[model samples]
Target: MRLLQKNKPVIRFLLTFFGSYLILAFLYNLYLNNASSQKYYPEFITHIVALQSQDLIEAFGYETKSIPSDYDPSMRIAVNGDYVVRIVEGCNAISVMVLFLAFILAFKKDWKSTLLYIFAGLVIIYALNILRIALLTIAIYEYPEYTDLLHTTLFPAFIYGVVFILWFIWIRNFRPKTSPKDV
Candidate 1:
């Protein structure tokens, strides 16, 4: 009981974070189920991400195209007519955003500021995600031998690193009004 009391704040934070994550993930899964029923492969957001990434690749002087994958609910992205990668629903990064949101909400502040921060953070994350996919597509196209390294290790590390940075920024600079010292 004494130890629990000493760790009350940490316990509360864990509960809030886990609870929020579970609820948001459940809701997002419901959305995926509904949205994926449409004709578009990989659902709406991922399809849009693929298209936007394709546009970015085209801008970089590479011929790029995306087609709905028949093998799975994904978009097969091809660079210069060679299929390089598939933009799956996981590539959309909504789940990562949801995880970010749960953290932010766990350290809840004023609603106005919290909502605005959430919106801005989501946009930053979404835009960065698009850019990440675009670059990854190009990288895989150019370095077919390093596909596993780029896809499985490097890119995932890079994106998750960015998220960790964002989380660090939030906690260090924009921490909630928990104590008198907190900003």
Candidate 2:
């Protein structure tokens, strides 16, 4: 009880922050899921994937095709004429949320650090996500057996690890110092 009382401000801040995020996420998901039969999410993800594909095709030596189907709600990318890559929208959201949380946790008490961290984090995440999609597209073309493992384990770990490293850098270089007396 005493500990809770002592940490009341911290607890309040956390509760308010998380509560607002959850409410907003829920509302957004609800709007995307129910507002239309097309499910704003899949198309939005497809657009992002298409843009990534265009960049990859321009930068790398790969060609991609878009197939329209009602079979699954995922972005499909074909590479080199034969291989197919299916990227689900949920996975993209998960990766993005991980990056967002990393920035939030890293810059919790400082607005300046928070703004810079968020901008850097978003750029990193966007670039990484494009690379991730491109790699997965290539992987599906080369090794089908490794697709599940890479998608389920390797990619998430790699991206999150990068975010963690960035958070550490932000803390070491940017976080404001507080004296013991302040605590």
Question: Which is the leading candidate under lDDT?
Answer: 1
Mark the 10 consecutive residues where model 1 has the least summed lDDT. 174-183
| Residues forming the 10-long window of minimal summed lDDT in candidate 2 | 34-43
Q: What is the TM-score of each candidate against the true structure?
A: 0.92, 0.77
For 3-117, candidate 2 gives per-residue lDDT tens digits of: 9987765676577657656765776677557543354436565556555654675467777764534577765566767637666665464445544654465347677667767
* Whole-model lDDT per candidate: 0.87, 0.65
> In candidate 2, which residue pairs get closer than 3 Å at backbone N, Cα or C atoms, i.e. clash?
none
Off by over 4 Å in 2: 8-13, 34-41, 98-106
Q: Residue 147 in candidate 1 has what lDDT?
A: 89
What digit string (tens of lDDT, one per residue) describes model 1 on residues 52-124? 9899999999999899998998999899999999999999889999998999888777788778888988998
